[model samples]
Target: MDVHVVSKTDNNTHATFSLPTPTSPLAGPSSLRIRPSLLSLTSNNLTYALLGNQLKWWDAYPVPSNAPTPYNDASAWGIVPAWGFGTVLESTIESIAPGTKLWGYWPASGHVVDLALKHEPDEPSTHWIEVSPHRQTLLALYNRYLISTSDDETRHAWEASVRPVWQCAYVLSAYVFTPDPASNPAIHPYPGIPSVKETWTSADADLSRAVVISLAASSKTARAVAHNFTLRPTSGGPLGLLQVTSAPGPIQSAATALKPHFATRAVDYTSLDTEEVAQWIAALKPAKILVIDFGSRDGGFEAAHKLVSQDEVLAKAEFVTVNIGYQQKVYTMSDVGAALASAAEHSKIQFNTSPVIEAILPVQGATKLFAGLEKAWDHWLENREAAAPDLQLVWGEGVVGEKGIEGAWTRLTRGEVKPEEALVFRI
Candidate 1:
């Protein structure tokens, strides 16, 4: 069996190892023996490794004790989970039989894993939750799995690459900055999570009378957010939008294709003029200004911050910063430290999809919420070519060699993967 492991302390230090396959029977009742068949690599995967210890992502899948030498040390090396499809080869639970296709989190490898799962009562028959004791600390979003019905490989590939992050975009638009406050109350940016104490009132979620700026506007999540924003009723708010990205041409083309009611403009990071942007935003006469940072390049978020903090006309309006992601690169220990410190100092409303989904489930119900999400997701999938014309899936096979997941991980660590490429693997 093949697997990939990364150093817990240094993401750049990673290798592909061929471990002996497990021969023991399923570990617990309702266990399924599964192997990740299709998976993807994105900057978000890097974030999972960088924040693994803090977020308990490392607990989801631990290295086997029998692996060779130091590579087997759980404290030093761990598997980074990826969002993808897994095929069940054996099952203790009768309802979920062998050959069943499941979609959710999986180790970024071809090795089979045994997971104890339980059906989520009152939810769709397709919904199952991982009940493994080792995974208890993971966010509920990661624990949950869905049975997949589609056989289309292209669609599956796209889902593997885009669906996970796109859901965050969906929640941010449909729940966080809710279009209809009466039906779906706007959730706190942190929402229901006890660790985050900041409050998010309706006033804070109101984009109806605001000018919104998205840094790293070409990012998949950012583009999805922009697409969702186009669906909002004109009466709901957000008088205009300013997108700052390195590839402004494609961004502007997508905005044009979406045909948002609100005014829209895209500018490259190098060409962004804070004063000019402030003047354009001031003309909108917004009641507030919201700056969403989706892992912008160096100084991109800082530039947007300067526009709202220093501009005479723009400073008068309410200012809010939502920290959604970090730049796509391997982070050093000092880089991680500085990011944590900066987030604390700025009081940035950090967005976590799990807590926000937990808060909305009761209000919207699992059926209604998931139904709505699927409808939106299906539409996006159908129109993805128009929505993200530049995105091209770069597929690889298996887990060990240069043209496989190992190579993909190396590219990610060195930041060689372009924003236009979506890396997927057949394992």
Candidate 2:
């Protein structure tokens, strides 16, 4: 058994490890052996590592000490988390047979994982939830696996590559754009969308009158959210969308891939000055601004300040910064002010920013969130005719050995990958 491991102590470092394969996994009805078919490598995977401890990503697949490796550093023992497709090689459960396809989270290192399954009747499905008593309560979202309902190989490939990112994008789009229930009773974001029960800073200005500015606009998750913006009519004056990217290439790519009507304008963040960005915001004539940052080079502070500090923009509009992912090493946010301070340090344009809020999907449970995501996914699949961009994915199967995984990681970290390409690894 061979697996690649990343060093938590030394940033941007990784190694490959090998282990002797057991003829059979521990015998029991609960045991199953899964061999990964494909793996997704993206900033989201990096986010998993960034918040591994807080989010319990490290525990997804813990490596044993017996695994052979050059260096036995304990800090590098953990496998970085990945979302992908794995085929069940061995299963003792009667309902789930061998060769069954499973789509969910997996470890980046080991090719196969021996998981103890517990049939979670909690949800009506043929699949079972991982009931390894250790991590059962850690994070249910990462623990459950869905039985691949489709027999078509092509569909499975698409689902395996795009599902995890789309799932996140779907949830973000639903909650952020869902029309206020008080204003539009008929228009609900998700079929059974729950309220944001967690403590999120209340929106100061009328969200219905806001324009959403998305940072890292070309990202798959950002595109998904932007796509939904086009589909749903906003209560806020015409639903205006603006995408901000670091380079001109991403701007052109996003504009070309997404329908021309999807964004009002695609701005290259690095080229524009604060006043220039402010002018663009002023042109929208929005009463308020909602900044949805997917992954920014220096977080969204620079972008946030441009809107919040500009006299022309701030006089008429109030702004809110909503962080979705941290592409770099995770920073702690003790309070709103502290978060803004961190952003200010890395920002090109500095100003007294408004509330920097972390956008948490205000849903009851992971099950509910997944359900809402599936509902929206179905809606998109059914309405592909209506100016929807098909899922764009890049499969790398020809690349052999652990080199593919390491190379993918290096490219992603350096931001060398194309904006529209969703990387999937078959190692």
Candidate 3:
């Protein structure tokens, strides 16, 4: 990976520097400052912040001098990068390095330059470089902020950590639906009004019912969905939740915790033949189902299809489902296509996404506790709340450096990443 040195003003203005030839890898002989990137300065692109203002997206890299390798000693934070770079695609903030494996993004902090510059008149992309030693901090941030977010896990294992992705999620959710970020309840089964242009409230703001959370227990998104449902007035009756999961223990405990607010209940796949699942879902004739998982995509669609085929009771509610796992490498491009085809074939449902929170919400922040978000609004929908599944989030992949991106590009072009290396991260 190439590392470059950046010397800037207090407000991140550019300075003079020289590029080293192959023989002179250290300092450049040209005393004049290096040329700045001619790219237009857009408010959207940034690598650092100075007094909340856009500072230069200065490129930092490691010199790898004879001295020991240098690394910033920051604590853990997840929601960092994937393995390559994207031109600020999904999220507003994008960080690309020279060579490093990526998981996701966290809010970025300082960076150390590491690239050795070599000029090419035809190419200016490699002008900036860094080693990306912040991977550990990003991961730790994810575990701390996003994972331990539930009301139960408020005191996370690593409260000291900071992450960007988690912050994004909290902010997006808070911005869209609720205002209070510090303590969004564990079972917000009834999310209030949304500020977004498009939103889907309950079928009849007055006709309430339990929210059917698919892939419950295991998913934090589902937990949030269930929490949204619970906040509603029960003149529509209690938020009778029917959670489906293969893992009974943790899920049941989670559901149990959801108690009176959601009146939590559970069912296993094997029980589908019995009325156990049907009766539970039939209670409010749940108008909506919120899916918080991709791993369950196939099975979830099949289940919804079966229920819709068999139950006239649930026929009235429009089934709403959203897949946020678009970039999660759980399945390759082909696998995702196949999954879509299979879901369409099995279920009458088709996705018509609402851009309530379009950006990929990376979990970032203090470990285990919910910090406030930057912008949050209401969830927009057409089918209303009775629709099964209001949302689903699959942790997306991030961009790495040029060479690492080349390797991923080569593999992606051929087909996939080595299966073994993939297990390390959800992407």
Candidate 4:
């Protein structure tokens, strides 16, 4: 088994592990072999590393360590978790067969892994659980895998690369808009007047004219949310879609093509200030506002916090906030401390700092999260072709790919990868 490992002490570097060949698997359900094909390394994965120990991300998939190597650091040898496609090579379970492709979470380090399997009642997707005991306490979503459908292989690869982030985006859409905010039990907790039959309150004039502001607008997840909003306009849609992006070029390109249908106006991060954002909110007077920040760098948090905290902005329109991504890597103890302190300062703004909160809504659990994403998934399946061109697929193979993974990590740590390109490795 050949696998990759990031230095426990350094976020910018990684090490690859090549293990001894395993004996043929003719054993029980506990014995299985899988060849991982594609890995989607986006900002979302970076968040796993940033909060790995704190959140138990490292425990999701244990990486086998080879002795006398740079990766020998016990604490650092843990593999980061990733969502991708893998093909079954050997399985003792009668339900699974060699060459069968499955999509779900996997260890980031190696090309191959042997895991325990627990079958679920057969369904349209032939569901099953990867019962890796170390991951038992983690989110059930991470443990579940669906038998990959026999579809266009390229399309499967693309979907595998993007689905993890989409899961977060989709669930978010359902939380805020689905079942109409007025009737949703979750909406009752918020201060604003709840809408009875719409996403926002029909009784509150401001709620009817609500606007959804997507920070880090260039991200596929954020764009997907904006796109989903257009598809499921059960609440008469928002007054407008406002995209806050540091690099407006790619988003502008996308917006140009999606205009009039998924119409959005891109606001440059550098030039936009709290006062300006306040003006945008105030302009939509008598309407509530929701700002979902998918950004993690260059004052992304500070600027967003300030905008939503303004008296003028909140006077006529209440502000709601949710965070989804961390484009910036928090590497060291100092970095962690600084972020904690910074978060404390922004606490005054009352933003939902974690996706888990909004995603699970009204509570925190995996089953509810998955249930909420079904509609968004349906919409994406029908409209994937139109959205494919905006994605950049970079292929990495074998030893070169191993080296490429390290390079990609370094670039991502520095926020060098362009917002338009998503890194997908073909190992």
Most accurate candidate by TM-score: 1
lDDT values for all models:
0.86, 0.59, 0.31, 0.62
How badly does each model clash, as a count of residue pairs? 1, 1, 89, 7
**What local lDDT score does residue 140 receive in model 3, on the 0 to 100 scale?**
28
- The clash number for model 4 is 7
**Stretches of candidate 4 exceeding 4 Å from the true structure:** 24-27, 65-67, 122-124, 176-209, 234-236, 256-263, 274-279, 307-315, 348-375, 381-389, 399-403
Candidate 1, residue 411: the lDDT equals 89
TM, every model: 0.96, 0.78, 0.41, 0.82
Model 4, CA-based lDDT: 0.62
Error of 2 at 333 (Å): 15
How well does candidate 3 match the true structure in TM-score terms? Answer: 0.41
**Candidate 4: pairs in clash:** 3-109, 3-110, 4-109, 182-195, 195-201, 206-286, 206-287
Which candidate, 2 or 4, has the higher TM-score? 4
lDDT by residue (94-143, candidate 1, tens digit) is: 88889888899999887899889899677877999899888999988999
Pick the lDDT winner. Answer: 1
| lDDT (Cα, tens digit) per residue for candidate 4, span 136-223 | 7675667778787765666666676677777655544544444354433232212232322233232332223667778788787887
Worst 10 residues of 2 by lDDT: 349-358
- Encode model 2's per-residue lDDT on 1-427: one tens digit a residue: 6677766644366666566766755567788888877777777777666556655677777766566654455556567877777888898877778888888788875567777888754454754678887665445567768888777765665566556666655544444344543322222222232322222222432345666777877676666666555545445333466677654454545445545333366677764355766666677677767676776666354645555565554566756555565553333444335655654553312211101101222333345545655776776555433322433567665123534777776676566676656677765
Look at candidate 1 and give me any clashing residue pairs: 208-237
- Candidate 3 shows a clash count of 89
Residue 268, model 2, lDDT? 74
The model with the greater TM-score, 3 or 4, is: 4
